[model samples]
Target chain A: MPAALQATLEFLRAYAGPLIASLVIVAVLPLIAGYVVLVERKVMADMQARLGPMRVGPHGLLQPIADAVKLLLKEDIIPEKADFWIFWLAPLVSVTAAMLSMAALAFGPAFQIARDINVGILFVVGISSLGIFGIVLGGWASNSHYSLIGALRSAAQLVSYETAAGMALVSGLLLGGSLQIRTIVEEQARQGVWFIFLAPVAFFIYMVASIAETNRAPFDLPEAESELVAGYMTEYSGFRWSLYFLAEYANMIVVASVATTLFLGGWMRPFASVRWMGWVDFLPPLLALGVAGYCVYRAPRQPVPVQKLVMLGVAGLCALVALLLAVPLLLPAAFFLKAGIHGAFWFVAKVGAYIFVFMWLRFTLPRYRFDQLMRLGWYFLIPVSIVNVMALGVGLVLHWQYRVNLWLALGGTTLLTLLIALWLVWADRKREAEALQARGGPGTPAADSYAG
Target chain B: MLDKVIFYVFGGIAVVSAALVVTRRNAVHSAVFLITALLATAGIFLQLRAEFLFVVQIILYVGGIMVLFVFVIMLVNLDVALQQIQFSRQKWVALLVTLALAGQVGAMLWWAGQPGKKTLPLPVSVAAPAEKLPANAEAVAHSLFGPYLLPFEIASLLLLVAMIGAVVMAKKKV
Candidate 1:
């Protein structure tokens, strides 16, 4: 080998895990995340008097991989007038933006790709914000009129939502007292309380922000072909087009993963009775790594079987997570039982539930207008999230004076939340009734929408 | 040996791609070349063992910001760069200014260079330590919040301000 080649090999050898891990993650994360998409679709299908994607597998398990192959082999076209190079670079930018955040996500107690970054949560925000560029460029480079308008809409829309999202994430970071992902997870493990209980308002804001960030369902106005002719992708075809789809779905996965790590106690189970089992504290970390590895290696070749294995593994991991959380309350036996019931089972169950909701909204909701989307993000989510952050801060300061128990604090927040929800619902119904009275009669539909 | 391999491979590519970024006739082509240059610089960061910076450089710079640059180049809708945008009689003036900028950078770097040590100032490891990671992380956390906390907080606030400014600039106020 030449001298430079020899040196390059050594460098690769030295930093093997991260370099290897990044490459591996780039390849498999899309596959894993896309399966969640299929699961979402199927779950939604069953929810509304129908079955979905059952023919692909015994229960449509292999649908994602099947979809992947279809995308890969699909026809790709390029417009003559398009700025071809920029159009090509757009999807790579989107996909790469989503994947790069993994460096800061330390998965296990010791199995982190890199460690000790002081500004991790901030780094994630900074880097993820860059996704705006991809959307803008993708829209513009297509050289179609629709694309430019769509890209413009996306640029404004994303910027507004991202601020709200960043503030929502800040609420989570404040509860942890440190920015590191692993430490945050361990805090939840030690306290046996997830941030969701403490920061329910933040959690709701984040879920909404994440949906918009991923450009999923009703928030996907930028790509709604009914108006903008495929939005930014009107001029793209072939592998290039598929790249954009992959990147979009991959970003959704990334957002979900962030949600998991931040508010879902990461790989820290809600129950960890296994730690008392002598070397059981190690299982949550192991399960995390094992699933990531197994999905990467086995998912491509035998996707149906691999997905089944992964799903089962997630259920088990959920139980473990629950057990880990309950160790404070339950001792070793309680830990194991909860791991079986709460920790390992809960993650898979929640992820499954979230995916179902994702698909449900996908099928049922009408796409928002670009202006409406922006208004929702800025006017609604941002203010609410800011209020939540201030409330959490107030609660934290008052903790010492009040001698407030964690459960009591949680109960108080929960009750406050219930009251707010009820009021919002009543207010919405009143507004609807008033609008109906103004329009003509209660039975008459609005002129603009048939569904009404 | 590894250092030399990285230097020759990525550094060479970086230099070539950067040259192409300016020299290419097509604006879109120039953007692609810039992406290549950015990727190679990320490789250099990887070789230097700043994994966090390396990832951010690619994710934020190569993937995020550069894509916007390409978008603007494409959306501005030029069949090609007009004579005004390309080489002109003022080309010599532009070239001279670029050279002056380079010289200034070179002089500053030369002043900062420590010949005593081989590499620039940064923590070194092929990867993070398998053990002692939490200690390393804690030290980093302490350093960030301890001495560098002011600058770190300022950077985040600056970003938030910039974000707000961008929204203001882009939005059509009704």
Candidate 2:
């Protein structure tokens, strides 16, 4: 072979693992995002007393695939006045940033693409933040008022919440004492407790800030449908629109994974450090088997033969997974396999639970006005998170420097933070009342309500 | 070989994007190019193994500052500005200044490449072995909070003052 070809082969050989992993992620993520959307629709339907998309396939299992096909086959459109180059590139930027952030995330002990990056979690945050450019650029390129306003709202919302989010993450990082995703999880294992219980306030702040950061409902003033027609996405259609949708879902997963690794103990089973909780290791396989059994039980109730066959197929698939999970536990020689597989199961489960909570909130809560969203981020969340960080720091100092009981220190600090948060809320309410009085009366409504 | 290739690619991107940032007629396009340049610079930091700096550059510069830049650019009426003269009247002066800076940089590069010449003045103790060097974030934290704590605090105070000035300026009734 020629020298250049030989060199290329050598590089490929060295990077084959990450290369394959990257390929898998790029291929699978869009499908995963689609399923997530389907789940969200189903959840919303359940909450709202309706069935979601049952016409597509068995229980709408294939709706995402159908949607994907439709999106791919749709006509691509661009406005006459649009900036052609940026319009073409914007969605690609969004999706690329969203997916690139995943490179640093540790999905399991054995599954990480860019392993051993010193600034792992920060890398994810920083790269994901870069996706804002996509929104801003797309909005600008569309040459539409709605798109520009939506993009601007998004930019402001993201910038405001990111500060609180970063501060909350700092509180967690102080406890973990590391930036590497793997190290953070390992620290939780070493501590015999998750960071959530120790720094509950930080976790709460992170949860709220993350929702706002991802532009989910209640905090989703950026693309508020009744206001801006799909926000920054007003001009996009077909595959390009799908790319933006995929990026949003991918961002959800990324934030969920970050929360899991930092506060929910990444891939560890519940009570992971407790020696008496060894039985939890068996729970994964048993849970899969339980799912399989439930599927089998429901298979006969399907109204159509095709639905029944699909249900049976799902059961079989679950059964195979259960077997796969069980075999490694039974065999001592496959220790790494057990750890890797079980770790992945728990990690994905926690991430799913997080996403479910996100969907639940989306269905339950009313969307906040843009001003209210900004107030909550800047006035409420920011101050509380800052105070929480300081209190947590003090608690850490007490625990390490003054020989205070760990639980006592953390619990005391948490209570103190809560009290401070209460005081802040009361003060804000008072200020709002005063401002209302200054505006003449409460009946008149706030002047800035529709400012955005 | 891989590291050199990666560095050159990123360096080339940074330079090209930076040039485009100044040359773009549209303000939004200029902001986008600036973001590209910032991202490319962050890549260079990653290549140099200054991991904390890499993320900080992305988070603070590309993410925070560039977003604000784009926001301001969008809020402004760009059509009127775009229709204005693209170049300033200081062409000769600008070229002269650019040439002088280029000459200074070229001279420095030549001096560094000279045989048996010490490129940088440094204490022997500052050059630690790679194995003994602290993690990037730890080293930064140590310096920021340890010996440089006073300076860091002062800088934060400076930022606070600037922030107050901005708020005061933006407030209608203040």
Which candidate gets the maximum DockQ versus the true structure? 2
The candidate scoring highest on lDDT is 2
Question: What value does DockQ give for candidate 2?
Answer: 0.72
Which pairs clash in the backbone of model 2? none
**Candidate 1, residue A402: CA error in Å?**
8.6
**Each model's DockQ score:** 0.19, 0.72
| lDDT for each residue of candidate 1 in A1-452, tens digit (9 for 90 to 100) | 57667667776787798777677777777777777677677667777768878766535766788887887787777677766777777877776766776666554444455566655665565556556666777777777789888787776666677768877888888788776666777778777777887887788888888788777778887788799888877777766776777777666655665677678776555544345554554554456556556544544454476556655555566556544554634465454344333343345445555655666778888898776676677656776677667666767666756878756665565566556656655665677688777886646556446564
Docking class of 1: incorrect
Candidate 2 structure quality by residue, lDDT tens digits, A377-440: 8889999999999999999999999999999999999999999889989998998898878886
